[model samples]
Target: MNDEKEPQANPWMKSLLIWVGILLALVLFVSMFDSSSRQPDGTSIAYSEFLARVDEGTVKSAEIAGNVVSGKLTNDQSFKTYAPSDPQLVDRLTAKGVEFRAKPEEQASFWMILVYQSLPFLLILGIAFFVMRQMQKNAGSGAMGFGKSRAKMLTEKQGRVTFDDVAGIDEAREELEEIVQFLKDPSRFARLGGKIPKGALLVGSPGTGKTLLARAIAGEANVPFFTISGSDFVEMFVGVGASRVRDMFEQAKKNAPCIVFIDEIDAVGRHRGAGLGNGNDEREQTLNQLLVEMDGFDANEGIIIVAATNRPDVLDPALLRPGRFDRQVIVPKPDIEGREKILAVHMKKTPLAPDVNARVIARGTPGFSGADLANLVNEAALLAARKGKRLVAMSEFEEAKDKVMMGAERRSMIMTEDEKKATAYHEAGHALVSLYIPGCDPLHKVTIIPRGRALGVTWNLPDRDRYSMTMKQMKARLSLCFGGRIAEQLIYGADELNTGASNDIQQATDMARSMVMEYGMSEKLGWLRYRDNQDEVFLGHSVSRAQNMSEETARLIDSEVRRLVEEGEARAREVLTDNLDELHRLAGALLEYETLSGDESKRVIKGESIGRDDAAGRRAAQMDTAGSSIPKSRRPGGGWDAAPQGA
Candidate 1:
């Protein structure tokens, strides 16, 4: 896609050349009018000489008619005298230091007159050439841009991404297809009493193909597509944004039956009253104009508007109301099938091993979007190249997937023996806790080997996709998060707990807060959202409002969260304590294998009492628990505890 502005010539130099040419033409015209007439008596005097002779009085009453100077001269004794050559008169004039000369009128070349007249033209031409060279030197590439909009127009050939190029956004594509149809055949829809939708807004997270879908719409429509970012309308100058908006709409109207795609529309379409600075007013003005252009009474027909934004929540309500942006399509991360399709699309150019399965890759990358899949394919190709391989193997794809999803594997990373041991136990603690938590998903793999920025990773794969989360499931997950810290404290005492659980602590705390304040999971809080005062911004503000709860209630909330963590920790410590020997054995095995499969992990968790196959089967059976296996009382304790401290 050609999203960049086109190269331009120097404006000042071009203007200078034009002005110089005009000046030269005027100078040449004035010089051409200086023609001389010949006197009747056969001798011709130059126009300048004629004027001088009239002033000098060398011949009285002289009539210089045509090419001849025929006039009677006052003499000592003479009535009329005419001489073609006056040798004595010439000698007398020469003595007086006056020079008189005559030449044939034909000798005065028009070309010579033109050359003299064009002096200014020649100077200007030289100046214009010099100025052009100087402008080129200083202007670089972009200089003739005073009025032109810096929008890149991507034709179908340049943007090869059709609907087929996009993956993981099936619903969004289906919604957009209606717009495409309307553009291709508006009469069909109009015959059914359906007015073509003026605009469609694509909302999603970054890398979710919002912008890509817009391009696809343009390509599918097969019309002139004008693309500019929302930020392009906004400028420091007041009314600039509004003017750009007007100009953009005008351009779109001229190219009627075309698509206008704006990426990141939030730049100008933000809520009017939400911004903090002067620029907000201008942006709001631009947004208002856009709303009018999209749905105004006189708005042009067959002109479709497509805008993509990650933060649709922050957009002006007026902009999203019925007529302006009637349809909002959400392009979310691809599901398993979508992921598989996306992977296939990306891997078309990559040479994959025979064993490489798009389904397997898709299944593994649950949250990956189309862009991420493309990146993954490219990364795999690069990895294969780095390894001096002719084709990207399944293993290479796996490595690339891991690298993109999680950071690069730190195989040669230096860690002390104590650190390594701590990491192993910490990871084991997580796996063990998850194993015991009934509602927690089944373990996928556990590795103490450094990967990305982590010293270890414990991956849990959900049995199926889940869109909603229940309180019980949330609490179980929170408990699992605290398990690593708990195991560290139990085995290595207080000194064992480290920053390894920083992310875990944060995640667990947020969940607990949401449970108490937002979810109303607490007995006292009821179903009300305690923190209902929104920050006026989308998704709430970065900073929270002042605490509304009393000091006592605050303390209680803190105690509840702590109780939840401690309970989970205590459970982890107990599980590890019971399987202490197994934990050590597994840790030793991990050092050798660098990773452990779900079956191997289950075997280690079950200890020597069960065989590997039996352990796997038993673990699978345990996973069938309805919700969570932990008893209500023993459930990773954290909510408000009314009982006294040690009770």
Candidate 2:
């Protein structure tokens, strides 16, 4: 994805090349010492043979030093001999008509001489040459570049990402469209005395297409884009980050009307002293410079700053103020409609079977981000390829969604028959409850085939994206969640219950607690948030995550959560009891198939004439007429809001 020119490797490559050259020079030096041994017809001769050769005038030339002789013979062969302590050696050699000469008085190996006499100087020169070459090779990227802006400059033509390429988060796009218009024609807004916002901050969860949106803004405006990460500004050296920030802005000003996008800006924009380590970290200095640069520039300068981060809560207060980041665009998870568009964008080039429908795929994905959709498409394509299919099919998409949501099918996982049977019943319980429970999301699929850590998985996709749920819907969700556990209790009894419901219990408890403590649904807790969860602020609103409650109030909250879970369990128990025969039939179907579709579940629900208790029947009939608004008593740990009229 990073298409930057493979950074000037010449610098490091030059250093490596120098070391190689030095190694080669050392190898040559070693080879030069052995050069004499490579001569042709070289022979060893004793002193007597040397004397005879000299006497016969067959010795052409000879050199002697420290009683050792070396020379080429009359036959053009090279020879060497030792003449140890002959008092008349020189005189005798001269008298025998041999050309004789005395060798150097040092009498040491030439390589030794070179090493001892000149190695240090040569080594110093080589190191100096290496350093100089390294400096020249790394002319602009190390110390010099530490303070230089590392922003990747993309030209108008190179930036192919436009608003068309991005879907989902339509509101976010609308928010940035004005900036694009302003960039394209400043006079349109200036005529009305309107000033463009100095900065726009994109805050959202990860993989929500923050960076993609930023690029789309740049591409739409058709201006040079400078893209850099927040971490790029920070360096090991103090003040380097600040220097880079100033340099980056100066460059942006050079290319006027350009957009400056910083991804993951929280890296440098976090509140000071909030993190551990240095008191005046480079990150802090960089943030200060960024603040000054953003403020120093005029709103009419045609330069707009855009930053993306999920952790906006931890960002410095100054950075988020109106004058600094005038607009805070929230890029939330895509709704069903937006998800379909995003999928369409990613699937543009993909070959799909006739059965593939973007809307259907989108409906199955409730909370997927743009990145998730793209990944899902890719996963489906991969599955098609693995199965040797030429085109991706809806079945492949279904498999991919399951893989993305519940993890892989995990067919390799081995389980005992008893365990599989229990899992089947458990999953059957969930499917049946969801199928019959009004206001609950329709069941999608149920499988005893284990995936990830779950021994079985039951999937249900919501009818649509709901911003708020009715009380009836919440109650239905409660019963659906507890259906599995209640089924286990009914089939195996209390004595034979397994630990498989651990996750279900924890999730149900958390849901109940959130409803009571934060949602203020509990009558005793009233309409107040008993607990504050300290979290990042997005679009001018902060969801407090910090706890704010008395110990007694906390105890009451715990009791309320326990009461909700128990109530859900009791409701599930009653439903299962009324349809005990249907439960067995469904469990049998699940055991045989190991998987059941929603329609298959409905088929199992048909032909069931089980009768309900009088009170339950009256409540069910009343629920059909009521508007899903139920009133409860003022007491804590109490069951559902006031029961249906007849109950």
Q: Which candidate has the highest lDDT of all? A: 2
In model 1, what is the error at residue 236, expressed in angstroms?
A: 0.8
Q: Write the per-residue lDDT of candidate 2 for residues 11-39, one digit (tens) a residue.
A: 56766888997887778676756863443
Q: Model 1 clash tally? A: 14
**How would you encode candidate 1's per-residue C-alpha lDDT over 1-647 as one tens digit per residue?**
23333233445666667777777767655655544332244344454554455456554444322244444333412122234444455455455454345444355578776776676677778677766665555421235322235455677557556888887788888888988888888889989899977888988888988888888888888887888888888766667677667777777777878888899999888888776765447777778778888888786788888898998878889989898888898888888888888888888888888989888878777777778888999999999999999888888888887788667888898888667666765776777777777778788777877776787888887766668788768777877786666655644554333456777777778788877777777776567665755554346656556347788877777776676666655665567667654555565555545678778877655553234233433443342244423222332333211100000
TM-scores for every predicted model: 0.72, 0.80
Distance from true position, residue 559, model 1, in Å?
Answer: 2.8
Residue-level lDDT for 274 in candidate 1: 72
- Among these predicted structures, which one has the highest TM-score? 2
At residue 211, what lDDT does model 2 achieve? Answer: 93
Candidate 2 segments whose C-alpha is farther than 4 A from its true place: 1-78, 82-144, 156-159, 235-237, 273-279, 297-300, 535-552, 607-647
